[model samples]
Target: MAITSANQLELLQTAEAVAREKMIDPDLVVQAMEESLARAAKSRYGAEMDIRVSIDRKTGRATFTRVRTVVEDDMVENHLAELTVAQARDYLENPEVGAEIIDEVPPVEMGRIAAQSAKQVILQKVREAERDRQYEEFKDRAGTIINGVVKREEYGNVIVDVGRGEGILRRNEKIGRESYRPNDRIRCYIKDVRREVRGPQIFLSRTDPQFMAELFKMEVPEIYDGIIDIKAVARDPGSRAKIAVISYDGSIDPVGACVGMRGSRVQAVVNELQGEKIDIIPWNDDAPTFLVNALQPAEVSKVVLDEEAERIEVVVPDEQLSLAIGRRGQNVRLASQLTGLDIDILTEAEESERRQKEFAARTSLFMEALDLDEFFAQLLVSEGFTNLEEVAYVEVDELLVIDGVDEDTAGELQARARDYLEAANKKALEEARELGVEDSLVAFDGLTPQMVLALAKDGVKTLEDFATCADWELAGGWTTENGERKKDDGVLEPFDVSLEEAQNLVMTARIMLGWVDPTELEAEAEEEAAEESSEDATEETEA
Candidate 1:
């Protein structure tokens, strides 16, 4: 239909209605309407002409204009849209070659087909505006909690009506086998917000560990006020959860604050989570201590942390083994998640057996390799000499201090130990050479003869090959795949190479090959230090 005076206000009215219904700005809808009208006008006024439309915000009056550009006589291509400068002088006192010549045009009488097309354009723009609005609103709301009504369930996925938009709580994100009917009120963590081609996706989760932390934040005033901080959280969905918290205020107990008086604060969160048991532990800077706290109700005899491997060994009394490991290892698994470590739990008896096995193994090695008697091997093992290298290189005085070991005996022991190591090195080198080990890698300073053989066996036979290896490949590491920690066996892991040592060795090799620049590395180190310093200062100020 035409933009008549009688229906001029109808355009603004429709824009307001759509904007209000979609919870978007009216200006966006009005602009969409103007463009749609201009497009419809173009179809009627000849597609070659540039048609423009303006709608008054206050009066809702529609104004249409026809535009043509003045060009050089030879450059004029379309008579409908462009005119030569000489021909434009008839319509204007002065017309520049690039200037637009605009004139008011009568509104187009839109046909049924044109009206439908214009309607589609307005709808498309409104849909885009709504999507933008939803994305903008929920993007920052990630890592937070939201309450909504369950609208429906499709293929086991819950669609939640969150006021202005719908949130999807996938089946995998639900706590256990939790089910809901239509119109059921629910609370979930906004795990992610993505703007995809179809629309903005608001992924809600009830099983996320952060969901529990946020619940405590909501119920615990100390946490909301920043007197207490939630350091970490681990959850088994509806079964159990653990939260590590720390108090900045000396007067406040972080655990007690989260637990509340008579367990009132924690009770609320537990009820909301379908009775999920929560253990609120005080966070500690010391990892082992923190792990001990994480595995509560289980008495830990000892905690040994391997920082480079990000793993920990926990020894408990025989009676507490079941408790420490929990039902199906739940307790230790949650503790590992909270501490970000791979935990290996053992009973006191088990640990003792392991130590005895190791001691016996060392004694056997000395007896066989050094040609020492059983008693002498036991004595050497008792003195903490676990390897031939240690025995060969230890101070002579250390060996002399051992009972019944004189200067001659110490010298003899060193000679035998060194002879065995020398023979072993020669054998390893021969094996490496047979496997096509390169001279460049063998002459490399850091790798031992055994290490070279191992590298050759693993197909890393050259300096370039060694330089291309990642530090983790040489030091061994843990990887999380499909949410389970898997051990990655490194070529040099058997030699007890730490990640730091592996990094240094690889970088040294790279520098020797001129693949890396020392000056650039120094500059990068300085930049990293400055960034770390700035971050620390910012954190201090925030605290």
Candidate 2:
């Protein structure tokens, strides 16, 4: 039995009802049917065959039209075919020999095969419409926090039903050490929303720093109301977190607001994070003090910052070193990331020892070469030359720029400086040799051959030069006419030594060369003094 027109109308109504339930547009379905029919006709019929199909959106009416060309000769059905003059006259009252004719064909009864084809077209259109609707719905929801029910687990990832669509929470994006079960209610931050061929894909993350920030916003009313603003957040999710907050209103304590009364607010966030610790620090413009606070639970005694290197050395107490470093150095590491600094932690004892060693090293170098007092050490510090090596290698003009040092004084200092450096290097070499060290001149790059020759000619070649030369004599006559020390002037200006400097130099050289024993020299002086006293007593007795 053939179906009536009413039956076709009933079928169209049924398809529209299904589309509405599936969130697919009815017009889009009808358009898909028409397009499918045109494709099917082209595939089955020749390309030259002109065919048009249309479907009524409101009514269940479909129509097809076939267009044919009018020509002089009959060659093909649609391309070069033509109707005789009598037939053309019957169709048109007056028709030209070369004119075309378009004839309307009655709608073909959609048989079983054709009906099946139309149904496939309708289903495909409905799916495309649904995908478009989903893409448009979720594209604007990125970065929003949403509550979802666990749908299923796939490849160690949890698929969540977020009302509109399913969002995948990857394993890495899940909070550390936290697990999810099927149908579990969880809140996650929407990390991304992407349009795929099938539909919109939403990505959820519980490990994102913004997740904690949004949680704080929800738990702390002051934040959501805009009285307090969270400036920054850093997390080692499932462990510890640091958040910097500022207040828009001067009267409000941003930290206190986030902490709530008796720690109720922050505790709520902590509970959500499975009891992970949170450090709510107030935002400060002072970098050093701010960093000190950022590395909390381990009090910082001092912070030496290198802005150019984006590095900071933090000094804490000996007892707090482990705390500052945390388990596997996590504390300091996170603090470094939070403050955007490369942090090096040192205990107070370590820092003090370092400073003392540095000071002693500098003092040893300056005292040996420059004939300088403690005042010179203070000057070197002010000039940013904290070590004796710097003083030994730097030019006299550079030293003169230091306050309390003049060109003449710098010249005298420089002249004595080379002698001091040579003595220091000789002492270091001797000590290294005694210790069976292979690299005796490891740090003696500043001791040039000319400097060694100058000190040698002055008799100040060993570590004992200071003991041999009087401070006044060494300081008084060390400069030339131009107030420049005669330092290693190859053949033009050979290094010269004054009588007093030469005497001191000789004593130093004798000690270094092992020609005179230091202990024997002291004993000989005591013996000579006793003999002179005994002789004076004998002369008195004879008289």
Candidate 3:
């Protein structure tokens, strides 16, 4: 083939058409064309030659050229790629050290192999452009619902043909009972959009809790308008789901609005979810009240919440236990997820049994630890003494509130509690000393005698050893072994310290040994004391 002005104009028109069809920039197509032609020219010309090609944007004229840079004789590694200033000055009026010397070269005829290679290059560029386009278009769609056609299914995963892109609905992301065939129209939540080496990956999900919430947002106008809000959603995917809603407008009933006129709105969401049962409940600010609402269709007699543990213990009527817990405990499990609390459900009978057992255990502990008779232990338990520490620390007035207890009896009880604690501490300190614990460590301000004993048993016999130990080692955290963090709690047995207490104690030891700056230590101490004072003030207010 011979190059002509008309053929060059036709080439540029073809490049423009290809660019339009591929949805890529025209300049990129032209660049790809130039590269392909240059590569094909390299096959005919020497491969070592510095070949370059440019296509005129205006006329589509193809210009083939070779580039060589002026260099010193010693710097010239390839004669074809570089020309000494002496040789370069022959081609130009002035030759600089880094100036490129361009020479025109004739275009080479494209063989079948060369043309195929050029086609592959254009296709690769077009694919990359498509991927970039898709990523930009769909990345913002995450956390929202999208409708698409099921293009294909591979090993249980569906490839959804979203407009201008393909989304992957992995097997696990699909609803448990839902299946799709080719060309089946489906709605899914865009869980994530990721840029990978191959292309942009749009991950769709039908089981995500956000998916259900988004569906409600679409069906319920109140939610979208902010008059009503979906506070939280928990789903078992195919079988059941629960949504907690709250209304900002006092007149609007969030649950009633979500339920629609005779449950049409919730039913719409249910229909979209392949008939999953839906429970719409109003959210409550109080945890106990919220928990009662969360466990619906079942009567709850009482709820005890442990805010520190983020746990709720619900006592239900014996007959309602089955209903409250649901089949296989799904109801309580979903309630837990919706409320963000660990829920333990029990019947009134079970709670009573547990209470009796706990009372017995506490009475036995008080009797053994403080040498109190069963009657005195019962009085202490009745007055709400759960631990020896409370007995040792409570006000004399609190102990006097026990029936038949005068100020003298209260003073005696306090005396016995303190005596017992002191004797136990003295025995533990002696044992720690016998086990070779350093006096500096035993005398550390924040470490208790029991803590010292536990440290000595763990081979932390020196102040340096105590300072070097991590808080988790002294208190509780996930156990790490073999470079893997396992789920085991590091509750340093016999010491009974919490993570915060362990950290504080370790920090105190470090400060005492001059391992930490006293200024930082003092600041931390001030902050901790302030927090303690605030907590005491809060308790006083509550009382």
What tens-digit string does per-residue lDDT give for candidate 3 at 1-543?
A: 434675888777877898788676778778878887888888878888889988999988888999999998789998888989899878988888999988899877888898888778877876787778788899998999999999999999999999888999999998885788999999999999999998999999999999999999999999999899888999999999999999999999898999999889989999998899999999999999999999998999999997745678999999998999999889998999999887888899999999999999999999998888899898888878898879887888887778888988778777888898999999999999999998888777777888788878879988899888887776655544894445434436345667788788777778777889989868988999999999999999998
The TM-scores, one per candidate, come to 0.92, 0.64, 0.87
lDDT of 2 at 468: 52
Which is the better candidate, 2 or 3, if ranked by TM-score? 3
lDDT by residue for model 1 (276-303), tens: 9999899999999999999998999999
Worst-scoring 10-residue span by lDDT in model 3? 484-493
Q: Tens digit of lDDT per residue, candidate 2, span 1-543?
A: 123476557646866887788776777776776766654554445455666677666676666667655655454344423565556787788877767677665555555676677678877887888888777887887877999999888888999998867899999988786777899999999999888876778999988989999999999888999888887788888888889898989999998999999999999999888888999988887778889888888889999996634678999999999999999888887787678777889999999999878777776556545556777765676567865556657877788888778877776766676667677667755654554332322223333344444444555444544335553343333234573333222210233333445455546546665768989989998999999999999999998
Off by over 4 Å in 3: 92-94, 368-372, 477-496, 519-543
Clashing pairs in 1: none
**Model 2 segments more than 4 A misplaced:** 1-4, 7-12, 43-52, 66-103, 109-113, 364-384, 387-408, 414-543
Candidate 1 residue 493 C-alpha distance from true site, Å: 2.3
Can you rank all candidates by lDDT, best first?
1, 3, 2
Candidate with maximal lDDT = 1
